[model samples]
Target: MSGYDIVKTRETLIMALKQDDEKAWAVFYELYAPVIINFARKRGCPKELAEDVLQETTMVLMRYLKNFQYDRKKGRFKSLLFKITESKVIDAFRRAGKISRLRNSELFSKATSEDHARIITERENIWDNEWKTMILRESLQEAKKRVNSRVFKCFEEVYLKEKSVEEVAEQLKVSPNLLAQNKFRVMKIIVDTAKKMIHNLEKS
Candidate 1:
């Protein structure tokens, strides 16, 4: 993640898309196609059906992106993507007869309405969790690259490996106080980087 510039990356991609730049479109697909496909798979869609949903989702975005407005206060671009994906997932379920009728607990009760609101909430939760996890992971990686190698190793030993502060400090031949300071410094870098990435992603 070294040298990564998320804000510049997003702006370039968006500008390329606005201009119908083929290379930018390809890069966009490479970055997001797998994420959307995995999201569908996590929602219980079969592999083939998930791929179909992804294709449909991409087509929809392509068709409408020219007219799409970017408004961070209203929502993020990714949220718009998830909304489209949700609809496609629902359409897939309907086509497969999964939503033809909702039934109560097995062995005999009257039909019930599908809880679409609950479904949407669940999917949104999934999306939010995944998105945050991705941002944090990338941030940590970038922080690792930017920090002093020894200090990062000490932080990793203490925080990531769950070692006692005294144990790791002794092992690394550094004072416990110094190790603690390194951990704090590295953790701050990771948190700050993640915040910046999230802000860039949310920018209109």
Candidate 2:
């Protein structure tokens, strides 16, 4: 489901979570678990290990959930979650002996607060990109369901497939102007949906 489909605001979800609402926790997990798992896999963990990392990260988040405070100036909640996931990734690598010196290295062992912040910022960037991509994809899927099939097809042909407008118009047996209109209409829906999804995600 698109983030737009989630009715509760981020604050509401967090409040419910604090109250030990099972539904809220489930919704929270559904929203973020895939991204966390994908981040681990992208960082080179195998699928099985990635899944393990996700579990470990989720448990850590649950333990510390109540301590979280929403402060946009500091960062989004995803940034904190990304930090936890990054820690888990390091732990996984350490366990596998992939980075034998990481634990004793200056970066981890004697890092200044600034160094840790820089590392977290880098991980947050990766998390943000993945989250945006997922939201955009979900928004596109949601927009497709709401738009006319022909209009969506026009969007696919002109934007996604990069077909010449004239070619697509000819194939669709429609005037160039009509095809262009369809493409514009579908594009608008997609962009609007994506914006909404991003807004909701950032708030969350």
Number of the top TM-score candidate: 2
- Per-residue alpha-carbon lDDT of candidate 2 for residues 25-63, written as tens digits (9 for 90 to 100): 776667677888888887879998899998998788778
Model 2 regions more than 4 Å off: 7-13, 16-30, 66-74, 101-122
Question: Which residue pairs of candidate 2 clash?
Answer: none
On lDDT, the candidate that comes out on top is 2
What TM-score, computed on C-alpha atoms, does each candidate reach? 0.74, 0.77
Model 1 CA RMSD to the hidden true structure, in angstroms = 3.9
Clashing pairs for predicted structure model 1, backbone only: none
Superposed on all Cα atoms, the candidates' RMSDs to the truth, in angstroms, are 3.9, 3.8
lDDT of 1 by residue, 1-204 (tens): 122353446464555666787776675565566667778889889999999898998888888778866555777677777888878887887787766553333522532345556666888998777667666766788788889899999989988999999899889999988998999999998888877766666554
Number of residue pairs clashing in candidate 1, backbone atoms closer than 3 angstroms, sequence gap of 3 or more or interchain: 0
lDDT of 1: 0.75
Worst 10 residues of 2 by lDDT: 1-10
What's the C-alpha lDDT at position 136 in model 2? 68
